[model samples]
Target: MPKLKVIAFDGTEFDLEAESGSTVMENAIKNAVPGIEAECGGACACATCHVYVDPAWSEKVGQPDVMEEDMLDFAYETKPNSRLSCQIKMSDELDGLIVRVPEQQA
Candidate 1:
């Protein structure tokens, strides 16, 4: 399993063990990490699971797809590193993935 680190809006941190193939949003929701509403589950249809990929891991995490990009338009305070957590699947390459949940969901 890959390791996941989720930081909440108030700076609380959740260190989790993420199963391979599971999404960052899934891990956050499963672990009850606040700030990741994931209202539409992992369908890529909503921006409620918005997170900021740590800058050091941004390139590895990659950019969102067209559908996700479209939904992200509804997220609050998006940045170059902003991503819909539900779209980020875990893998060996993402063993130490780190993400920060937003203060508010879309």
Candidate 2:
């Protein structure tokens, strides 16, 4: 399993375990971590799972797909590093992945 260190703009932090195949949103949701709504349930339709990958960890996470890119427009604070958590797969290389949730969703 990989470890994810998901954070929020308000300083909330979640250090949870995740399988290599699951999405970041899935692990966060399962752990009841605040800030990741995943309202679309891992689908690309909603931007509730919007997150900003820490710049230090950005290159390791890679980029989002077209669908995710489109959905991100609905996010509160879309940035160059913004991504839908549902689109990010957990991996050993992402053992310490840091994601920042925005202040609002919807």
Model 1 stretches with alpha carbons more than 4 Å out: none
Model 1 earns a TM-score of 0.98
Give model 2 RMSD, 1 decimal: 1.0
TM-score of every prediction relative to native:
0.98, 0.94
Minimal lDDT window, size 10, model 2? 5-14
RMSD of each: 0.6, 1.0
Off by over 4 Å in 2: none
Per-residue lDDT of 14 in model 1: 97
lDDT for predicted candidate 1 compared with the true structure = 0.94
Supply the TM-score for candidate 2. Answer: 0.94
Query: Best by lDDT, which number?
Result: 1
For model 1, how many clashes? 0
What lDDT is reached at residue 57 by model 2?
88
User: For candidate 1, which ten residues in a row score worst on lDDT?
Assistant: 34-43
